[model samples]
Target chain A: MIEVKNVAKKFGRKKVLKGVSFTAEKGQITCLIGINGVGKTTLLKAIMGLTPFDSGEILINGEKIHPGTYEKITFIPDTITMLPNMKIREAFTFMADFYNSWNAERAGELLKFFRLNEDDRISDLSKGNAAKVNLILGLALDVDYVLMDEPFSGIDIFSREQIADVFTSHLIEDRGVIITTHEINDIEHLIDKAVLLDNGVILKEFDTEEIRENEGKSVIDVMREVFQA
Target chain B: MNVKFNNRDPVYVQVIQHFKEQIATGIYEPGQEIPSRRELANQLKINPNTAQRAYKEMEEQGLIFTEGNLPSRITSDEKVFQRVREELILEAVGAFVDSIRTINVPLNEVLQLVEQNYHKKGDSL
Candidate 1:
C-alpha cells in the first residue's frame, strides 16, 4: 500500500498540496480528481519523490521512500518524455537500459495491443499513439505501483477507450494504481476509489461501489454535491 | 455479454442481476462454464475487483459453484434455478404494478392490455 499522510508542498508563494492524505491499496485503482491547477500532478510527483514536499510523510509498504523505491513505483507523466527523433524501439531500449524493472516481453505485448510499429519514429506517430507509447513505458515495468497523470486528457475517444481497456486487462496485473484526472466520464466504472481535491485540500474520499450501493449516487453526483456546495 | 450498466446502482449488484436474468431466460445453461473474473471484467469493461465481488456474491447465493481448481460454473440445482425464474417474474410484475397503479388504471383493464401487448411483442420477436 501507498500512504500519503498530511503531505504538503509549496512552490514560492503558492501552496500546491495542503495536508493531503489517502491510501491506495494493492490490486485497486485509486483516482485523484480535481480541476486544473488544483495540484493533482504535484501530489503524484510528491509521491514519486520527483518533487520535494515541505512537510508530512509518504510511506510505501510502511517504509519511507528511498533510492531503491524507484524499482517498486513508477510515474507516467501526461506527456511522452522521449526525444522526438527516437524511434519507438529506440525508446524501449532507453527504458531497458535505465530501469532494471523493465520487462521487454510485456513491452512487446503492449506494442501489439496498441497496434503500433515500433520502427515508427516518435515524431511521425499521432497524438494517441504517442500516449500509448508513454503508457507502455510505465506499464511494462515490473513495479508494484503506477501513478499516471491525466492519461486521457488530450486523446481521441477511441484512443481514450483503448487506454481505459488497460485497466481491465492482465497487463495491469493486480498492481496498485493512482491516476489523476480532471475528467472522469470515460473511467467512471473503472476505478475502485476516488479522492476529490480542490484548492490544495481533499474535499472527499470514498469507495465508488459503496456510494452507489448505499446512497444511490454516482461519483459525479457526489462530486456535484461536494464541489458545488 | 454486453451490459449497459447504470451509474446509480452498484456494479456488482448489476452484474448479479444480469446473471439472474440470463439464468431465468435459459441463456446461461445449468452447469455451464462461465468466464473467469478477469475475463468477465474485460468483457463488461468494469473493474476487476467489482467482477470478483459479483462472483463471490453469486457463489454465496448458490447461483454458481466451483469445484477444486476448475473454473466456476452455473449451478445445476433445479430448486435454485426455479427460484431465480420466479423471483425475476415477481420483481418485474411488481415494478409493472407499481407504475400502472400510479396511473389509476383498473386491474382488469391493465391485465387485458398486458395480455394483448405481451403476445404481440412475443410474436413480433
Candidate 2:
C-alpha cells in the first residue's frame, strides 16, 4: 500500500498539492488524471522522491519513505529520452542494475512482443518503438509500485494497442501503479481509481466504477464536467 | 477478441468471453497465436487498452500465455480448454434459457423445437 498524507507543495505563490492525502492499495491501478500543467507530473515526481515537497509524508507498505526508499517504485518520466550514446540493450542493463526486482525474462518477453530489436540505439529508434521500449522497461520491474507520466503521449494508434496489451499481461496483481496521462480513452476501463487534479489540488477522487455507474460517464466525460472542457 | 466498452460492465470480461466462444467453435485452435492487440483494436476501432484488458483477462483465466518474441497463443492443455469451453456453453445456454423462460415458454416445447432444429441443421450440413 502507498499513502500520501497531507502532502503540500508550493512554488512561489502557486500551490500544487494542498494537503492532498490519499491511499492507493496494493493490486490496484490508480490513475492520476488532470489537464496539462495541473501538477500531475509533479505528484508523481513527489511520490517517487524525484521532487521535493514542502510538507506531508509519503509511505510505501506502511514505512515512511524519506531520503531513502527510492527503490520501492520505478518512475517513468515524460521526457525520457536519455543520451543517444546507449543502445536499447545497454539502457535495459543500466535500469536492471539499479532495480532489485528487475525481471529480465519479463522484459525480454515484452520487447519481443513489441518486435523491438536490442541492437538498436535508443536514439536511433523511431518514436513509436522508443515509446514501447520506455513503457516496457518501467513496467517490467517486479517492484511494488510503478509510476508513469504520459506514457502514450506521442504513440500511434497501432503501437498503442500492442504496447498496452503487454502492460496489462505483465502487471503484477498485488502492486500499485500510478499513471498520469491525458489519454483517458485508452485507460478508462483499466483504472480502478482516479484522482483528478485541478490548479494544484485534487478536484475529484473516486473509483472508476463510480463515475460509470452514477454518471454513465467515461473518464473523458468526467474531465469534461470537472474541468469544464 | 472484439470488446465493447459499456459504462456499466467491465470490458475485459466481455473480451474473455469472446475468446472463449471463438476457441470453443474452433475459430482459434489450441497453441495458435492470436492477433496482436494493435491489430484487434484497429479492427474494432476502440482504445488499445481495452484490447489489452481483454488479453489480460484471458491470461488470468488460464486460456492463453505469451511466448517471448511470439504473439499470445491459446493454451494447449486440454483440461484448461475443456473447462473454459464448458463454461462458455453454460453461459450461452443460460442466457437463452432465461430469455425463453421470461416469455413463459414451456420447457417441453423448447426441447421439441431443439430436436426438430437439430435434425434440420444436420441435413443442411
Candidate 3:
C-alpha cells in the first residue's frame, strides 16, 4: 500500500496540498479527483519525490522512498517526456537503458496493443497516440505501483475509451494505480476508490462501490453534493 | 459478453445480475465453463477486482462451482437452474405489476395486453 499521511507543501507561500491524507491499496485503482489547479499534480509529484514537501510523510510498503524505490514504483507525467526527434523504438531503448525494471516484451506488446509503430517519430504523432506512448512507457515497467497524471485530458473519445480499456486488461491487473483526473465521466466504472480534493485539501475519500451500494449515488452525484455545497 | 453497466449500482452486483440474465436466457448452458475473472473483466471492460467479487458471490450462491484447480462452471443441478429461470420471471413480472398498478390498470386488462404484445413482439423478432 502507498500511504500519504498529512502531507502539506508550499510553493513560495502559495500553500499547495494542505494536510492531505489518503491510502491507495495494491490491486486497486484509486483516483484523485479535482478541477484544474487543485494541487492534484503537486500531490502526485510529492509522492514520487519529484518535489519537496514541507510536512508529513509518504510511505510505500512501510518504508521511505529511496533509489531502490524506482524499481518498485513509477510516475508517468501527463506529457511525453522523450525527445521529440526520437522514434518510438528509440524511446524504448532509452527507457530500457535507464531502468532495470523495463520489460521489453511487455513494451512491444503495448506498442502493438496501442497500434503504434516503432518507427513513428514522437514529434509527428497525433495527440492521442502520443498519450498512448506516454502511458506505455510507465505501464511496461515491472513496478507494483503506477501514478498517472491526467491521462485522458484533451484526447478524442475513442482514444479515451482505448485508454480506459487498459484498466481492465492484464496489463494493469494486479498493480496499484493512482490516477488524477479532472473529469470522471469517461472512466467512472473503472476506479475502485475516489479521493476528492479541493483547494489543496481532501474533501471526501470513499469507496465508489460503497457509495453506489449504500446510498444509490454515483461518483458524480457525490461530487455534486460535495463540490456544489 | 457486453454489459452496459449503470453508474448507480455496485459493479459486482451488476456483474452477477448479468450472469443471472445469461443463465436465464440459456446463453450459458448448464455445466458449461465460464470465462475466468480476468477474461470477464477484459470482455466487459470492468475492474478485475469487481469481476472477482462477482465470481465469489456466485460461488457462494451455488450459481457456479469450482473443483480443485479446474475452471469454474455453471451449476449443472437442474433444480438450481430451474430456480434461476423462475426467479428472473418473477422479478420481471413483479416490476410489470408494480408499474401497471401505479397506472391503476386492472389485472385482467394488463394480462390481456401482455398476451397480445408478447406474441406480436416475439413473431416480429
Candidate 4:
C-alpha cells in the first residue's frame, strides 16, 4: 500500500497540500477526486517525489520514498512529458533504455490496441491520440502502483471511452492505481475507493461500493453533497 | 456485455443480477461457457476485481461452476436451473405486486393488464 500521512506542500508562499493523507491499496483502484485547484495533481506528484513536500511522510509498503522508488511507482502527469520531436517508436525506445521495468511486448500490444503508428510524431498526433500515447507509456511498465493525473481531462469522447476501457483490461489487473479527475462518471464503477480533496485538504474518504450499497449514493452524489456545501 | 447498470447498487452485485437474468431468460444456455473474468471486465467496462467478486458469489449460489482449471460454465444441474427460473419469476411477481400496491391500483386491474400484455408479448415473440 502507498500511504501519505499529513503531507504538506507550499508553492513559495501559497499552500497547496495542507495535512493531506490517504492510502492507495494494491490490487484496487483509488481515485483522488475534487474540483479544480484542489491540489490533486500536487498530491500525486508529492507521492512520486517529483514535487517535494514541506512536511509529513510518504511511504510505500512501510519504506520512505527514494530515487529507486521510481521503479515501483509510475506517475503519469497531467501534461505530456515526452519530447515533442520524438516519434512514437523513438519514445518506446527511450523508455526501454531508461526504465528496466519497461516491457517492449506490452508496449507493442498497447501500440496496436491504441491503433497508433510507430512512425507518428508525438507533436503530430491529435490531443486524444497524444493522451493515448501518454497512457501507453505508463501502462507498458511493470510497476506495482500507478498514479495518473487528470488522464480523462480535455480528451475526445471516444478517447475517454477507450482509456476507461483499459482500466478493466489485464494490462492493469492486480496492481494499485491512483487516478485524479474531476470527471468521475467515466470511471465511477471501476474505482474501489475515493479520496475527496478540497482547499488543499482531504475532505472525505470512503469506499465507493459501500456508499452505493448502503447509502444508495454514487460518487457523484457524494461529490455534490461535499462540494456544494 | 453492454449491460446498463444502475448506480444505486454495487457494480459486482449488478453483474451477478445480469448473469442470473441471462440464465433465467435462456440467453445463456445451461452448461454454456461464460467469458473469463478479464473478458467480462473488458466487455462490461468494469474493474476485474468486481468481475471476480461476481463470479465468486455466483459460485457460492451454485449458479456457475468451474471444473479444475477450466473456465467457469453455467451450472448444468437441473435442480439449480429450475430454482433459478422460479426465483426470478417470483422476484418479478413481487416487484409487480409492490408497484400495483404503491399506486393503489386494485388487484383486478393489475391482473387484467398482466394477462393482456403477457399474451401480446408472447404473440410478438
Task: Give me the candidate number with maximum lDDT.
Answer: 1
Q: What digit string (tens of lDDT, one per residue) describes model 3 on residues A97-203?
A: 99999999989988898899999999999999999999899988999999999989999999988888876774558899999999898778889999999999899
Ranking the candidates on DockQ from highest down gives 3, 1, 4, 2
lDDT of 2 at B56: 79
lDDT of 1 by residue, A1-229 (tens): 9999999999999998889899999999999999668599999988888889999999998988898898889898988889999999999999999899999998999899889999999999899999999999999999999999999988999998888887678444589999999978988888999999998999999999999999999999999998889
Q: How high is the CA lDDT of each candidate model?
A: 0.92, 0.77, 0.91, 0.89
Order of quality (TM-score): 3, 1, 4, 2
Better of 2 and 3 by TM-score: 3
| DockQ, every prediction | 0.80, 0.13, 0.86, 0.77
Model 2: residue A161 alpha-carbon error in angstroms: 1.2
Q: What ranges in model 4 sit over 4 Å off?
A: none
Q: List residue ranges in candidate 1 displaced over 4 A.
A: none
lDDT of 3: 0.91
lDDT of 2 by residue, B73-102 (tens): 999988987887788889879999999999
Q: Candidate 2's error at A10, in angstroms?
A: 1.7
The residue pairs found clashing in candidate 1 are: none
Cα lDDT of model 4 by residue, B1-125, tens digit: 68888777999889988998898888998899999998998999888888999999999999999999999999988898788889889999999888889999988888899899999999999
The order by descending lDDT is 1, 3, 4, 2
TM-score, predicted candidate 4 vs. hidden true structure: 0.95
Query: For candidate 1, lDDT tens digit of each residue in B1-125?
Result: 68999999999999999999999999999999999999999989899899999999999999999999999999999999999999999999999999998999999998899999999999999
How far does residue B121 in candidate 3 sit from its true spot (Å)? 0.6
Per-residue lDDT value at A17 in model 4: 89
Give the CAPRI rating of model 3: high
Best by TM-score: 3
